[model samples]
Target chain A: MKLISVNDLSLQIEGYFAFKHVAFSLSQNEIIGINGDNGSGKTQLLEAIVSNKTPDSGTIDYTPGVRIGYLPQENPQVIEQSTGKYLEEMRRLSKKLAVRKDQLQAMITYMGLSPYLDTPVNQLSLGLKRQVDFLSAVAGHPNVLVLDEPFAFQSEKTIQRMLDLIIDLKNNNSGIILSATQFDKRIATNFDQLYLLDGDLKNIAAEQKNEPVSLLVFHVSPNSMAITPDVEDFLVSNQDNQIELEVPLKKRQIILNKMVQLNYQFEGMRKIEN
Target chain B: MKIRILLKSYLQLYFQNFLYLTMLFSIIAFELLANHLLEIGNLKKFSLLLIAMFILSLFSTMNLYYNDSRQNKYLKQKINSHWADWSSQLLVAVITNLFSSILIFIFSLLLRDNVLVDFVGILGLFSVGFLGSGIATLFQTQWYDHSTVGQIGVLLFIYLAFSGSVVNILTAVEWLLPPLSKIIMTLQVTSSITKLLPIVGQTLLYAMILFFISGLVYKKNRKNA
Candidate 1:
């Protein structure tokens, strides 16, 4: 069943165009990864889904009784109070979800935040604060999770823990939509559905099953490259190069090897798999 | 449930700021000492002091609410929690005013050698002032930038309508039709308002009216929210 459906949705921010006629659906237990370059309306799309921004024109249909949880790219200001108080408050607000008070404490512990529970949030590191905010959103046990840049500023272990939490939520029949610039291969391997926004307001359609994927695109500097992959493909580009290559989805190791062998200073890489 | 959660969180925040609480207590103590040294027994003086306390408490509550609103987690979770928005503001106003009143009551008994009558009067003033302030905050939150002017205007109109003798001229000329005119007239005089209605009754009435008005404003704001 589709938990969230957005049809012909468009949004504009500060008179600058953000998204246009964007359409997508999130099914039960499906994890949809949204990949795009910076300023590609990835965050705006996530915000629109959570009702933070009203679409300029379109229809958004959400499943009744299905809660939507969003973690924005920018960390919210930390309350000058202790982490425990923050988590307790979140737990109280989400009390209708059958979450036990101890579970909240456990989640804090799992995030390596147990010792910091009594410490003021403002005193914590930026990464720790982000973790706290992330836990708060998931603690509500939302049926549809919308996470924006969950790995930003997070350590590898913390990212792994967050991934585990997402998998756990998925096992509980919850759907997840994540947007990030750099796509973790583990996440792409685990999550099948993918959407790409290519410096435009709309989502670029995925490549067909029978077609041979286009591997590279040559364009002027600053123009976003396009990828037509049969499945999901990873792209690793040189820092000075203008052309972008589409690495086979399963051969990320090979792409990494090629980049290293070519001695090309890489800008960034992401996986587009669905 | 959301209100309960917000209330709990607010109280926790209050406790966390122990230094602020200490400073607040010291200020209250200094005021009580000043009042005792002046030997002022007039109701007007007492009412003015009560008003000052009310403003102080309201300022503190607003500070806390703004702080909580800045919290990313709180704002994210609370936007969907209907109870959090209304009840948090209401609880802050009510609780802070009640605490201030209680402190004043205790101070009056200890320093002024006043009877239970003065204690009750102070309680009534606190209650009415709390309700009025709560209603003001509700308006302020809903209207955002214009709340300050709007609240001041509303309070000024209420005071003028209730106490201004000019109201009688309008009534005599049959030029103005006012609701609650009789009640305002009855309570226009301080002695009658304090004497006829017990402090509890006056406070309850004020609280009820303010709460009702706030409820209406909140309903309208929630639709916009």
Candidate 2:
């Protein structure tokens, strides 16, 4: 079932000519990556999805009871306050889905933030603060997570951990949408689909076998190829003639000797035919 | 369930402000210092200062409430919860009033005179502060953060008109103003009022009325927030 559908949505910032038309459907258990250059309407689109801002003209139909968690680009400050006190009050007021204090604690721990649990949020580094914000948003186990640059300012290890959590949530039937400038290979490999928002919003799907494959031809220098740890595996993978390796631009003799000692084939570089 | 979560979030945000505790301690210290400076025989001056401190406490809480409503994300959610919003406001008012009254009583005790009068004065101060805060919150909910100057003008007008010999005017022209005169009268003659009904009973009645008004305001604001 489609959790959220945005059709012909257009947003215009008042007094400015900036405007964009957006349309998309988010389905259950899907990981959709939104990529775009700076100044594009990526953040605005996310804001519209989160209901933080209403579109100038469009339809955003969200299923009621479909919990939407948004991790904004900027984190708000949570200073030295007793978490239990606030949580207890919320529990008393019955404003939360779950009053299980352990779940909150667990989320804090899962982010590798147990030691700083009692510390003020402002005292934490930018990366750790993002983790806290992410954890807080997902505390109720939201059905759809919208993360804007979730991996920004994060270490590789932390990013991997967050990816694992996202996969876990996806497995549990939660849909994930992320917007970022650069895509990690791990996320690119795991994501179910990709949507690129260029000068104009565009959605790109993975190439299917029956569909015409647009050649994304590029040359790999022999110097770069010589550094390949497993040349045999690289050649075997290139048997489809989709990849072309070029001769090294500089340091060719040294790299050639290394490739020869490793019993690797060093064909003169040529561009791949589409 | 949502109320609990929101309340928890608000409390965290509230405590995080750092200014809250600082203001609380400042009120207590100011009361102590004022008590020390007053002449031992002049209970009226001490009583006036106590009233000022009580007023300060109310204003501080009002400022906090305004800041929270304006800034706290979860408070926006709680504003939608009729029971939680009203109940929390009432609870905060009662606790703040009680704290201010206790501070006044402690200061009076240290001065070592007119204990009964001071106690009665403290009760009156508490009633005024509680009712004033409840009214302010109601007004705030109805009007979006009206100017501080306007609020102060109204409050000063009320004090000038009702706190003195104008009580007779207020009583005679009762229909002109709401039952605010009756509440002011009760506060003005708290000693006799408390004599008629026990202090606890009087406080309970005051609290009940405040809650009732707060409930109406809460419903109105919940629809608006």
Candidate that scores best on DockQ = 1
Question: Residue A247 of candidate 2: its Cα lDDT?
Answer: 28
Given candidate 1, what's the lDDT at residue A208? 34
Query: What TM-score would every model get versus the actual structure?
Result: 0.72, 0.67
Writing each residue's lDDT as its tens digit, candidate 1 over B1-225 gives 666656666665545556436645765676667666776544544554544554455455555545554543436344565546566767766776777776765664433444555555566546644744554554455234355765675565345424443455556632122122233343445552245245445445655566566667656665653
Error of 1 at B122 (Å): 2.6
Candidate 1 wrongly placed segments (more than 4 Å): A36-41, A74-110, A114-122, A184-186, A197-274, B12-41, B72-79, B83-85, B108-115, B142-204
* Candidate 2 Cα misplacement greater than 4 A, ranges: A8-14, A17-20, A36-48, A54-59, A79-110, A114-122, A181-186, A196-201, A204-274, B1-43, B46-54, B66-71, B74-82, B110-122, B139-225
Residue-level lDDT tens digits of model 1 in A176-271: 999988576556767757677764433333443332433443333443333333212444343444546665555545654554444443455554
Q: Report candidate 1's interface RMSD in Å.
A: 3.5
Task: Quote the TM-score that chain A achieves in each candidate.
Answer: 0.76, 0.72
Best by TM-score: 1
Q: How does the DockQ of candidate 2 come out? A: 0.15
